[model samples]
Each structure stands twice: as C-alpha cells, then as structure tokens.
Target: MSIRIPPASWAFRGFVLCFVFLSSFPGTILTQEVTLDSIRIFTTHDWFSIKPTVYFQCKGENKTVFPDVKNTNVSYSFKGEESWQPLTKLEGTKCKRCGIYEQDPLTHDTFDEWELCPSDFTAEGTYTHGREKEFNATFLCHGCSQVGPGSNKESGTEKEEERRGMRPAIVVLIVVLVLGVAAAGLVVGYKYWRKKKRQQEQARFLKLFEDGDEMEDELELQNTL
Candidate 1:
C-alpha cells in the first residue's frame, strides 16, 4: 500500500528537520571585548620626548591610546571610562598578535609584542603582560573569565546536554513515522476485506437464483407428463 502525503506537509517536515539539525550544533563564535584596567611603563622606548603618546593595537585593527601613560615608572589606572573602552575583541581562547607602541613623528616604536590569548587571563578577569625594560600592563575581559582550560568541562557538559535534548525529538519523529505507516496499512487491509466480503455475497445470490430456475423447469416437465 502506498501513502500519499501532501506537498505542504512535506515542506513543513523538511523545515522542522533542518531546524533540529542546525540546533544540534554550536552557535556562532562571538568575540569578547577586552578593556585596559591598569598599566605601568618600566621604560620608555622614545627618548628626547618629555611626554610620549602610548597606545596598544591588535593586528589588523586600530590602536587604543592610553592618554595618561606617557612617563616611565608611572602606574596609570583606568576606570574603564576611556573613549576607546574596549581594547580588542577576542573569540574564545584564541590568540591574537598584539603589542604596546609609542607614537613617533616618523615611525612608531614597539615596547613589547606578544600573542595575547583569552585563556591567559585568570578567574578574576585579569591578565598581565610584561617585558623587561619595556612595559607592563594588565587587561580585563569579564567574558574571558568564563573561558580557558578550566572551561573545558563546562563546554563538554553543555554539548552533552544538547545531545541529550535532541534525543526526545528524534524518538518522537521515529514514532510518528511508524504510526503513520501502521495506520495506512490498517486502512488498506480494511478496504481489501470489505471488497472480498461483497464479492462472496454476490456469488451466493447468483447461485440461489439459478437453483430456483432449475426447480421451475423440472415442475413444468412433470406437469406436461
């Protein structure tokens, strides 16, 4: 027996399947913004400058200047109220090439360069980078605190939960398909039984009519005798 499904219902089923498949995987990787909490300059890269302009930059991005951090051995702290509040955006624990530089008339001088990773930060949402005779600075990203090596367990748990959540949907889909097939089979079987019963009744009726005709012919022959 063949079951015919409507076109609109097929489209709806396709949409639901796609939604479930897409939802099973992780979502888009969003970048977290990092801000400068505090910074101290151990030494100045530019000489003959009473007050030098210092800034930090990630690769392929614009620089975030520290207005107060100009003199060496001076600790500059920020309340995260700077015009350029967030220094950079980091995706998960991935690292980016970033450095502190001193602005110059001709060329910018680099104080320190390193690969900055979100995993390097501590649970308190603080990360410090330092170079001898160059500079030392602390950065903050509250989002980073929830990431790192320790977050592996949490991530794994989340993934497991997602998998578990999908189980019931799949089971329901299977059960529905099975029940549809069973119902279709039952309808076809019922139709076939009804047709067979009607054919048997018609055959019995024709047999009874033929017997009556033979009996009538025999009685007429007796009468003629």
Candidate 2:
C-alpha cells in the first residue's frame, strides 16, 4: 500500500516557499521611504519680512511642511528619526515631480520644482539639489538603488548638468576644428604661393640669361660684318 499526500498540504508548502523567496528581496517588493536630509532657503516668497511657512510636496501627494525651516539662507538638517521624517514613499521605479513651496494667503509660492528619483541619490543614500536664488536641499532614501529604474536612469537635473557641461566642450572642440582647418588652408595657400614665386623667379633668371645670349649673338654678327 502507498501513502498519498493531500493537495491542501502541497498548496500550503508552496505558499510558504513563495513567501520565503519574496521575503529574501524586500527592497523590490516594498516602497522605499524618501526623507528630507537637509534644506536651505536662499530666498523667501513671502512679501513681508515675516518668515515663510515652507513645505515640500509632490504631485498628487500631500505636502510635508517644515516647521523649523522658516528663515531664509539658513541650513537645517534632519536625522530621519522624527515621526514625520520620511516625507514620502517612492513606489517602484517611478519618479515624482516635487517642489518646495511657501504657503501664502493668495497663492502657494514655489521655491523650486524638479523631478525627484531614487536614481538621484548617491552611494550614501543622499541627494542634493540647489536652485539659484530659490532653495538648496538634500534628501535621503536608503536602499533607493535597489528600487530605482536601474543604475542607468539619471535624475533630470544631473542629465541637464551633463548636457550643459558638454556644451562648452563641444563648442571649444568645434572652434578648434575650425581653426585647424583654417590653419591648414593657410599653410597650403602659402606653399602654393611660394612655389609660384620660386617658378617666376627662375623664369626671370632664365629670361635674363636668354636676353644676354641674344645680345652676344647680335654683337658677334656685327663683328662678323
């Protein structure tokens, strides 16, 4: 007689094995928390001298206000240990259009706006952005690399910077190439002009010798006469 195993038991074992396999890679399955590491406001959008009520927000997500960062040109840092420390959670490889804004009575004045991505962070899990006369900020998100669109996906700011950096080099290279071509043309022209001049000089010298020979022949004929 052969003992048979129940289908329910097999199903339970399979479920447990799947759960264990998934648990091995928690970074891929769970949303990673993005926390504000530091921030510095260069200018305030508020008209009056009163401190601006600054906050961070992404599209479709509620604002994460910074109660302490009320002054301009002051840098504030965080330990990501507060109750509201993790400002938001990044799902999968998706990037969020986020910005820092000043709360106002009439309108919410924006400090700076940018695309935030997990790929923006460094090996230390930190990302920094500085908008001229607007704001400078640093963000932290541990295990961001594991949940990002891959190592190849760069932040918009970094890509823009790379493009900007390449422009000057490209312009310089083009200028150098143009100058090189112009120099080569000048050299060829000078060589051709020199060769023509040398040929003209040789022809002039030969003509002088020929004229002398003719004069000598005329003198000889007269002497013969």
Model 1 agreement with the true structure over 103-146: per-residue lDDT tens digits: 86655688888877777788888999888878888999887766
TM-score of each: 0.55, 0.58
Q: What local lDDT score does residue 20 receive in model 2, on the 0 to 100 scale? A: 62
Among all windows of 10 consecutive residues in model 1, the one with the lowest summed lDDT is: 21-30
Q: lDDT of candidate 1?
A: 0.76
Candidate-wise lDDT, in order: 0.76, 0.76
Candidate 1 accuracy as TM-score: 0.55
Instruction: For residue 195, give model 2's deviation from the true position in Å.
Output: 99
lDDT of 2 by residue, 46-163 (tens): 7766676888899888888898988777889889987767788875555778888898665568888887877887777888898898888989988776654454555668656765
